[model samples]
Target: MSATAVILQNRFSNDGATILSVAVDGRMVHESWNHTVSTNDARAQMIDAFLDLWNVYCEQGLVLYVSSRTVRNLLKEQQELFDGLLIRDTITGAMFRKTWDVCSASHHKQRREKRPLPSEIEKEPTPLVVVATDASKGKNSKTVGLSAVNSCGIIKTHEMELNSIFDAELSAINFALQQFGKNVKRLEVLTDSRQAIQYIQGRTSLQST
Candidate 1:
């Protein structure tokens, strides 16, 4: 089986961005294209992007990143027409995991090959810090509690006032990042707020006044 992977990301309405990335040889070497779609209609933009990617990597395992559940449902409903392709809302899905693992291993191998022998100081590298953030709203009040917990058993909490739960969730993320981001090279943040994730990923946009 030929090891080929393709990733499609359609963000036309949010910022007119449409991206396609391809990798081969079980490596993360990517040949990517980014185009600014001229269309303003969200559904049309998504369909156009999907069709374009589908046409190019029809034989490869195509993975799509789209925020619209409607489009995902439509594609799911038509399984026979889009067989062999993986429709995903996030990069952590199975289709992306294999591609990502291949890329990561390739990069690490190249780095190891260039490094000197074991004559230098040998110490374990710092582990990646993973943080989970959450926010809870007070009953019949604007007060909110924001908490950030890390893998190291460290917990940080704050209480504040926010207009809505969405705001509180977003604020919690910002607070967590601010508290744990400094002087750290690698950090992973986990949150259960889908709306907050969508906002941070630029999949959902706020209306301008």
Candidate 2:
């Protein structure tokens, strides 16, 4: 089975940006650098970027290959998401171990034949982020949550409760996207509730505004 891996080069820190490279079969596929003001907040942005990359791989039917270190750090730092996803260090380590073994065997065999290493496989370009929001309302209160994700997983999340859940959910997404700024290549809005998704997609009109 073919696999795509994302290797995080730099550590998350306040001083420098995070760098990530996407590859398949030892070939570099996609690379990007993100400047972060706050390391803690930057994690959400980083996850969003990775999710975008994951969507692209999924489109091509490729399994993800993440470095053991990256997986370990992610588990430690983002325990909530890691636990929710049921990710463990051992699982991630095993994946990397398999990849290393394959690469090593290929390198040793090539040395015997005096042949150049096989060219790295290139991956499809990354996809755009998808935002999903949901809201619920009580007699006098509302609750809302919005998730930013791609094919791979959820990158960022925001939730709150207000008098009107629908309004809160929409507002939450709008505010969250503002942080990303403009020049967003593509976007897809989703909601678990049909009414909310349709309203956002413009299939249904918002009578009030």
| Displacement of the residue 17 alpha carbon in candidate 2, Å | 2.8
After superposing candidate 1 on the true structure, give the runs of residues whose Cα lies further than 4 Å from its correct spot.
1-127, 206-209
Error of 2 at 156 (Å): 65
Give one digit per residue, the lDDT tens place, for model 1 in 38-152.
Answer: 5335445556656766776667656654445777677677757975676666556464567756644544443344443576436454457789999999779999999999889
lDDT of 2 at 26: 55
Whose TM-score is greatest here?
1
Q: Predict model 2's lDDT versus the native.
A: 0.51
Q: For each candidate, what TM-score against the reference? A: 0.38, 0.30
RMSD for all candidates, in order, please. 24.0, 24.5
lDDT (10s digit) by residue, model 2, range 1-209: 43535444443345655554444545555555556665555556546645665565544534443444555467457545422223233324556555445544443443334423356433433457565544445575455555554445646666666555567666656654664324456756555655555677688776322
